[model samples]
Target: MDKKKPKKVFVEGAIPPEKIAQSVANHQSKTNIGAHSIFLGQVRADEIDGKTVYAIEYTAYKDMAEQVFHEIRESAFLKFDITCAHIYHSLGKVNKGELCLFVFTSSARRKIAIKATNYFVEEIKAKVPIFGKEIFEDETHQWKVNK
Candidate 1:
């Protein structure tokens, strides 16, 4: 088990581009990390039943979601020889083309970093309780179904 405390993963709104840059910058001092992989999940303006999605309103049971996220991270650490990992997911409203999720992983090798990042993304999409309501251009909305 990871002895580190769980990280706060939920952001109140769409993640800013600067935040992504800052995250990368923060890792510059970690010289042992030979490679880094990142995954960004953006809100897509999808046309559903003639209505176009313009944004997504996300909500979650915060406490439970955080616990699950911590568990996933712990499992990832045990499964991969990653030097570092981070995950940020948005809550509340996020406009189309905005970022909703950010996953970062670092390792001594390129393949390990890339595989760790992919594992985080897939596990998050399948296990997290966070829900997204896709808002249409016409002001209608539908609950998004994760694939």
Candidate 2:
């Protein structure tokens, strides 16, 4: 019989800071890493031509999103001598200035952790099938992908 292996990285719904911290701790428990670096992306309310962004609604093609995320995890592991990595992004409505995405990478050295964090975030943004709708104070909205 083929044995199924448990997933190392978790991907789920609107991730809170507490949840992310918990996952980081869980990953760290089994890792002998000396450094952990995290990068969190937050939604910001910005005024565009007198219109103020009040909130954001996030949506994703879940199947594709998961596939993309999985690739990112594999790539990170192959590229960096890292112990573990975790990524979470919000879905549905998120208020202005709220946390949107969280990425944590731990490695035996700070240099690897830093490099991995940057590469992970960039790859996720560029490759993920996540979309965002920016809702303005006036109730108008627009869909945008991370540039």
Candidate 3:
């Protein structure tokens, strides 16, 4: 039942604060949307092996990742009464405290929007082929595994 075409979900570097605002502003004309839920995934400065992570360099099998993203979006649309959904992920280096992911869902009801947003975030984290290389402050890096 996935009718939508595959979308390029990856953005370069970190997702800008202005992009989020613009997304919200862009949806104002959709009068049927009563509630919107948004999730922002920020990079954390984690300490491991006595080194602190300063950034994450992200990479993915682009073609496969885009298809998976399309499937997820279509699944969300079929499962929820959401009017709109948007997902963006960062590629390349995203520094600590910067946003790496943004998920937004809108529906006629508050609960539906929130549930759809949650579903998108969960599915993306679990199913997407995106990989992150955790870059330490000292310039060393390690491949990060999602938990």
- Predicted structure with the largest TM-score when compared to the true one: 1
- The segments of candidate 1 whose C-alpha lies over 4 angstroms from its true place after superposition are none
Candidate 2 has its poorest 10 consecutive residues by lDDT at 1-10
lDDT of 3 by residue, 17-54 (tens): 99999999999999999999999999999999899999
Error of 1 at 42 (Å): 0.2
RMSD of each: 0.8, 3.2, 1.0
| Model 3 ranges with Cα > 4 A deviation | none
Better candidate by lDDT, 1 or 2: 1
Q: Model 1 misses residue 115 by how many Å?
A: 0.5
Sequence-dependent TM-score of model 1: 0.97
What is the C-alpha lDDT profile of model 2 across 102-139, one tens digit per residue?
Answer: 88888999999999999999998888888889999888
> How much does candidate 2 score in TM-score?
0.86
- How many angstroms is residue 54 displaced in model 1 relative to the true structure, after the best TM-score fit? 0.1
